[model samples]
Target: MAALSRLLLAALLAFAAPAFGLAQQPAAPEAEAPQVLRFRFKPPADGRLAYRIVQRDRVVFAGTEKARAWSHVVEVRVGGARPPDMLEATITLSDVRLDEGPADDPYYLVAKTLEGRALPAVLHDSGAPVETAWAALKREVAAGLARHTDPETARGLAAALDRLDPEGVTVLYRPLYLASVGHLLGFNTDGSVRSYDDYTGPGAVMVDGRWAASAAGRREGEPVVLELGWRIGMDPDAAARALGPVLQGLAEAAARPEDRAAVKARLAAELADGMEMSERADAEYDYALALIARFTHRHVLATAGYGKEAVLEMERIAP
Candidate 1:
């Protein structure tokens, strides 16, 4: 019986050894390399979705729209020895999130396009010239503005230009032409400024110029009002260089206590609109002046709000 027990134990040990050895073996390698980023979004307009892959602020690929509902599946090649490539198709849900991996991942090569494709962004493919497109667009806009200063034309064109994918020439150049025409003659007659904090409030700025106007809205925190506006006139190049200093000076002055008071007093006199007298009104006045001053510094007439980030748009402007 003792000998039989020993034999049985030996047999069990032999079977267990093979099972354990198989478990210790390394697992099969990953099927495909990790992807860079994956996003899902509902189709817009035609539901035909296209992807613009960017890397280092340059667009590498604008994928052809693969329409299958709103779902898209984009595979951005990350790193390694070659330029990141796209996967089979973008056939995922419209609300997909991104999953990024190591730098060595191929996806990083195409990350720029992902970032640059924002609503108000420009896409520049590696084969395209973002700077040149910007420059040409700016030049066309400047030339057009020189010819006509129509606010509708200017604003329309600016908005259109802003929509271009920085990667392609056609997309970049269209806005330039539109903006140029607008700057030459772009001013609307209906100039209205209302304070949201105090409707019919006194703490707002309204300036309708030969080609542009300044509009103010109610202030958020503090009893101040926010101001915004656009205008078109003057030589695009000369204005950018010459008026830039003046605009900067105004920005500085508006932020100053004394200057803020002076501007408010002047605005009241100009509009003859009832002034809502309050110490806080100075802030609203200052805000308007600052925006105006900044506007003066703008060489290119952009219709949207870029604020201090205006420099990014400026850098893209054509010479």
Candidate 2:
């Protein structure tokens, strides 16, 4: 029986090897690869970009799996006074829709409110807003919330504003600011893409590539590093909002000797790793544009059996 099983396995490998086309071995580096590649945007003459973004999320918890997605179109226009390297833009959002999953879900519903809304000043390159811009956005957003006359809605919005204040709003709005620019902006010299193996990648600009690769080139081929891992910060404001409340509650509750003992014992069991519950994942990006024309960054969360995965993707829709 063992010998038969081994023979069958060997036959399977023989068949699979041919079907898989061996291993897609790399060509001679000098022959196929450019001396260097450039992966930076060539801004249009109008200093405007029109794009479509799709946000997707899936979760499996206690034997149930759920997926949700939102699609929206954004237009960004840049100009006015700013630093040499930095640029400010008015970002407009429209045509928002819940593309997949639960239609009544709050996560999907919130996107509807963004229809025809415009952010006055967000960084053109990074998608993040400047400090003053953020302040203005927050004020405008709060005013919108205050327009709710119902007691329940008003209270809920007030609580949300308080809780999401400081950095929480930024965390939630990161996708809006980013619009998947991270994938398009960070390329090494020679137009090469981000290297997850090294932290030097990401958050770089065209100038950074000029310094590293000497000069940028129009990529005739795909990126050298096609697939790599990326560490994404989904809810950077977590420490202050939900997590902070729990820690603060624990501190307040541990006033008595018995309470302190109980709290310490519970923490010892739960917090063995010192305040980090995270996993690394290789985010998904579709280089439709990266290869030749426009592109999309389909940033996905690996989840690693934790059962929570998300994808924030965007595409260049118009010239």
Candidate 3:
């Protein structure tokens, strides 16, 4: 009977040992530290790269909510194996949807019209378009302009209507513009220097197989893997200098409360005149597009209130 009791006690303790051991087990070997990959910007070789970009924009004014979202796939190909290369990019927009809260929204209309169109563009090292791919965009915007009846906004848009380069409009509306700008900024003129440090923040890291930056302790992968935070505002002095007498008159007129409405009207007319002048006097559209691209890229990266958000995911499709 003594031997039997001892055997039974041994069995009971053996049964409880595993449960006790589990309670003190060392936490599964500390989850094996996450694999981290430090990103280095390599000058892209002569290969094709593909990416899917999702863009979301939302606006709220006077308790009215309006939202517009779209997704597009971009394909970029590098032509030369060496520096001073040419880039051929194609953007195809899809899944564009809009939710407007019973408010008059023309932007929603524009987005709807832009869906399902693949725009192909080519650019040289200087960011000059090698092909005229603005025909489709010009047609679309012209139609929208004709249909747009809002006086307050229409005038401003109409003022710069003819001067609207597809590249400039694209930079305003899509994330692929950033990719183009990034490509240009990533490589030097001769493709000798590849510096990505200027575009990445201290918190940038690879997380879950994607490059991400920590903002407010949360990882964000949008438009860029890292936040460049490039904000280049239009220099008022430069604008004043460029406008010369026109800016002076507008400034003087805007100083008076009574002349505000008149000043606005004059401003619109002057802008229209300036567009006409730009078209007739010089072929500065290419240069203007370059400037606009840089400005728009910086503006998108810097401004949080624009309600514009873009996510860029890169996949190496070929060697």
Which one is best on lDDT?
2
Residue-by-residue lDDT tens digits, candidate 2, 1-319: 1221222222111211221111123334565453433333334567676777677766442234577788777676766646654566677677877678655333333335445876665453444444324444544554554332344544455446544435432323444443333334343333333333322222211111111111122223544324322232222133223243344343333235556666445444333222221222222233443321232333221111212334555556666
Ranking by TM-score: 2, 3, 1
- How accurate locally, in lDDT, is each candidate? 0.24, 0.40, 0.32
Task: Give Cα distance to truth, residue 187, candidate 2, Å.
Answer: 4.1
Instruction: Name model 1 segments beyond 4 Å from true.
Output: 1-132, 150-319
lDDT of 1 at 115: 27
Q: Which ranking of candidates, highest lDDT first?
A: 2, 3, 1
Model 3 CA deviation exceeding 4 Å by range: 1-84, 99-111, 124-132, 140-161, 166-174, 186-229, 234-236, 239-319
Could you tell me which residue pairs clash in candidate 2? 36-190, 37-190, 37-191, 38-190, 38-191, 39-191, 289-294
- Top of the candidates by TM-score: 2
Query: RMSD in angstroms, candidate 3?
Result: 21.9
